[model samples]
Target: MKFIHAADLHLDSPFLGLTGLPSSLLATVRQSTFTAATKVFDQALAQQVDFVLLAGDLFDRAEQSVAAQAYLFQQFDRLDQAQIPVIVSFGNHDYLADQHQTVAYPKNVTVLGSQVTTKTLTLADGETVAISGFSYPQRWVASDPLPDFPVHAATDWHIGMLHGAVATGSDDHYAPFTVDELLSKRYDYWALGHIHHRQTLNQQPPILYAGNTQGRAINETGAKGAYLVTSDHGHLQPQFFSTATIEWATATLDAANLTTLTALGTRLTDWLASQPAAQPTLTALTVTHLQLDATDLTSLRQGEWLNLYLRTHARQLKAAHRYLVSVTPQVQPQALTAPQLDQQYWDQGAAAVFTPANLQATFGKLAQEPALADWFTQATQDATLRPQAEQVLAELMGKEDPDVS
Candidate 1:
């Protein structure tokens, strides 16, 4: 028996943290989710898989995107025409709701409900498979759903579909279950979702997360796709296939002895020329071993230099089919030298100033605005805030030696 397991399609979800993108590139970004999903269906048809399992989050219910809805209808029809069965289980983003339930998917598609239910399929080879899963009733399902899931069914193969996370001991919004608990069910396979990084929890029974179909942000780097599982020697084996048309990557460029913005631009162009992706790539560039004067460093720190470089080097970027999302400086603390003030004192000052409370207070009324509030929440996260603070300190220290530039 063969089937494809995929999740987190996130169809028509807006590309996050993108700005100043060329209109053509923006259009591609907008359609990327759909494009990635189409590839999954195309593969399903080509492989002639008996069934396809979409673990969850087919689309963002909050967005209520018309295009996403229409695209699914069209694709499901395509699968129906090919006589391929599709099993869908909606996750947190597109949970089971009365409004969505009003419109039914095509006859070929079986959408799992809020309660744990089992669907049995008979493969062409006379193999019987039982699939058990459930969709989220609301935004969160606090309770462990394992108790509701029945023991392995009396079938040739039993596969479990789940869109959730591992137990964290506290309040877990998603359906949280431990690996041991899942193994206790004695299912042949577990097609998991929710987390956007594809990974296998168990090898024997093939428990795994298929990850998101496409990369929407820089953090979701590398090849994003789904799994094609085939029964091999009484064991279910899964293989990953790429579906993402636009890939997100982070690369560190060594800027040692490179001084001017023009030199950096040339280096970046050369780097793009050397490392080419099959699909259009969006890169988050980090410059290490960088040495720049006060003004240049300030420009890099403020993203002014990177923006200017991008604007000036449009031809090179287009030729390489690459876009620089951001350029971050990865300089050491010792590199940010201030003749007047000690590094320890500067660090102490930063420690006092860059706290969450301080940042929230500084943001003041901006927090009241929804869009700004969301940005503020992410921007104020420790990972983001620490780098920004370091950049600011570097800029300030660079200013100490104004004549050096």
Candidate 2:
């Protein structure tokens, strides 16, 4: 009873990292889906996995690109030929808004229809696996839907799949759920998604999120891949596999005492060399750096040459790793720590800024400002969310340059 469990294949995801991707990587925007889907298909074939579950997010948007659709079809074709069943359901990102139509997928594809229900897949050997799945009908479902799932049902093995959050603290407001509530279902395995970071929600019965196929943004950094689940003497766990064509990485070069760009270069060189070397055929890399101070050190190659400088070092990195460095300095730290970099002072400033009253007052005053009128109007309606917004705004304002040049 082995299956390849993957989710959040945000096909044709515009760009893998973030806005303003380099020109060289720009053309691959629409082709990201194809690249990632191709890898998944190849991996599935190599692993000879019996089933594949696309827990949700089959498209980046409701009206996904034709190129993306074609690419998906091609992958499904391969799966069909291999006789592996691919089970799919629409996630919030690819929900009803998803205008995907007019493309003929292989018979092996099981596009789960809307409305929460169970689909039973009986293998050729007469062993049965029931996938009790549900999908996001809209962009947001604020209510607790975990209670809606079938509990302790009769089945060989029940794999419950849904897309939401299961948390205990204030962060639970993000998606809202309780592990104890999920436990009521008593399913054999839970293949989940939505929160795009690989996590194990329940070790007792094994509830897991495979995370996004590839890191879609800078915040979605680090290793991105799928999971392979197998039962050993009726016990199971997941093995994380790296199938991402392009890897997104971030390294912060502390430009503190190292006042020279040459030092920064060598520092960056060491960091790049440190990245775990992956397979030979992988996509480019984006490296963002946060620097301090602005010293016109001659060792630092200026303009286009800087990238080339890093590229030269990147090439000398591990043999299997191929990457493009994306450099971003975090407001140049010396500037931030400077007396006026932010009206930002030292201990007192950081403390006063984080204080609740100061944050609320600052946010309330800023909310009254003319420039923020529209955003203010929209935010006022939700009383529960007001404090969060205020806290965030206060942080931003507190961090602003005390002297605006």
Candidate 3:
């Protein structure tokens, strides 16, 4: 009746967008995924949960990381020793493929296959639970897999494990299913995955995404962990637990009186000393309500200021157990209102320049590099790129006085 639900382990994956970190912090980043995952296993052993459900993306198969494979084998073996059953449904990142078919996990680990299947386990407390799910055969499912899922089984509890997304009507590569479709099956619980933000779609039957085990990037900020679900008064309840050794956070600093890089560094150091986190935090700092000359703004924009601050303020950062991942200027749209240029013109310019084609054209040869291309693609899809574009335009406008006549 009790189990731990987790997803998107992303084991042995390198932390993205990190540069010039301290040697000790860099080592922590390398082991963060494994360390976070160990907390989940540790919880399982301590709580003596009947089973564990890993919804999906346990690891990126494309990376071919030996450390990830070995870590899973070792952990699964540990779970087996504790007589805890682990049900895993691999998502797109670690889809079922021929290359890793030969390797076997421990006896307690049951990796669901490509076809929709149900695995039933009888708990020591005499409760029978049926878990139904499927692994991604390849990178994309591209279809409604609801029809393939069977009806609720004749057991004490029925849980559906899905590594997919909500139906977006078009261009959905992952297995897409609506909440209605999930509720139609009348399962006791839905352990969802793929989306890296934890959310609950329904409360009664406990439909949820456990999010990623650790925060890997600035966008994946805040507490990162899994859920421990237990049956309570005929209803299943999920409680979150933090597993991340290092946390990612974004904070806005008021730069009303700040005019120079030295002042910015002092303010940042003071801010770090004021705030604290239980775990080492990697912070993305944004300056607001500030006016800077082109040269100073360019330093921040080009990361020259941030790099210099990191080097000079290493002692402060180390004392706070924090790292400044980025320092950005929040340029308000109202600040860009020029005497000659109208808001309409700015909007028109944005419309013309911010298109995907334009971005791709501007990206040019850099797109040829796979890593940069992937980053560009994800950045374009998210809202991160628009503000950057706006900041660039604001800088250009700040430098030149345009004539309407």
Candidate 4:
């Protein structure tokens, strides 16, 4: 039997914090989610798969996007016409709620309830398949869901669908479950979601995450798409297919050869001309070993120089099918020193100051604010925070004492 497994459609996701981009690029970004999703349905129809499994996060209900709702209904109806079934389990972002129940999808679509239940399907060839999963009752489950799931059913194939993360033993707000727990169920395949990067957790029974159909942020880079799984012998094999209309990437440019901004511009243009992309690619570029003067380097890092370059070389950017999302100097770690102190002293100081407890204490009451608190929580977990901080400190100290470094 053959089927499609996909998750995290994130339909109508407002690609937030992208106001700096041009209107034309912004329009493409806005439509990218829908475009990516359409490709999944198109693939389903073309491949003539028995059914499609949408593990979770089809859309964010908070956006209140009518377009997203309409689009799903239209796509489901199309699938219905082609006699293809779709199984859906809502994730945190699109948790099971009253609004979802009120507006039912096409008859062919089977949306799992809030409680763990098994949906059995009989394929055209008279083979029985069992899919087991649950939708989030609310935004956060905060509990282990493994206890609710039963052992593999007495069918030709048993697939376990889960939309959560691995139990980290702490701070697991989603439906947490362990790989060993899932393996105990003895299911033929495990389809996972929640995490946006596609990965295989097990090779034997074929447990994997389909990832998001489209990347919504800069951190989610590379080809985003679903998996086409086919039963081979006694195992299910999954093949990845790209669906993202646009891609995100981080690249570094060596600038040790050029000393002037004029030369830099020409070099950047030539680089863009050489590396043409198949589709629109949003790039976060870092210039390393830059030979420019302090003022020119500051201008480049601060966006003053890059802004002029982008405006002047709009045609070049379009030709290369790339957009410079941000340009920053590569922060090379340096031994921060003082007239009387050594690198060891600086390291010791940083170790004491950058501790999570100390950072939280420093944040103090500002942590009461949810937005800032979340940012602080992530910041505290950043492994490179101390090194980056040291680099910044060294740069500041160099202005005061040239002999310090």
The estimated TM-scores of all candidates read: 0.84, 0.70, 0.88, 0.87
Candidates in order have lDDT scores of 0.85, 0.65, 0.85, 0.85
lDDT of 4 by residue, 156-267 (tens): 9999999988888766777888999999999999999887899989998888988899987777899999999999998899999999998998888887778888888887
lDDT of 1 at 226: 98
Report model 3's TM-score to 2 decimal places: 0.88
Off by over 4 Å in 4: 97-102, 336-381, 397-405
Model 1 residue 179 lDDT score: 97
Off by over 4 Å in 1: 98-102, 334-405
lDDT (Cα, tens digit) per residue for candidate 1, span 1-405? 899999999886777656656778889998899999999999999999999999998885545566677789899999999999999998877787623443467999998999999999998889999999999987678899999999989999999999998888754667989999899999999999888889989998889999999988887898999999999988999999999999999888988899887788778889888876666889898998888776887799788887777778787788887898999877676455555678799778877987778888988997654234434554326678777667667767665767663
lDDT of 4 at 173: 72
Q: List the residue pairs that clash in candidate 1.
A: none
Off by over 4 Å in 2: 16-33, 167-175, 254-257, 260-263, 266-405
Model 3, 374-401: lDDT tens per residue? 3565533637787765666676776675
Model 2 per-residue lDDT tens digits across residues 269-377: 6665665456422333322343433443222323343555545664555443534444434332232233444453554555655554664566686644322322333
The predicted structure with the larger lDDT, 2 or 3, is 3
Q: Candidate 4: lDDT over CA atoms?
A: 0.85
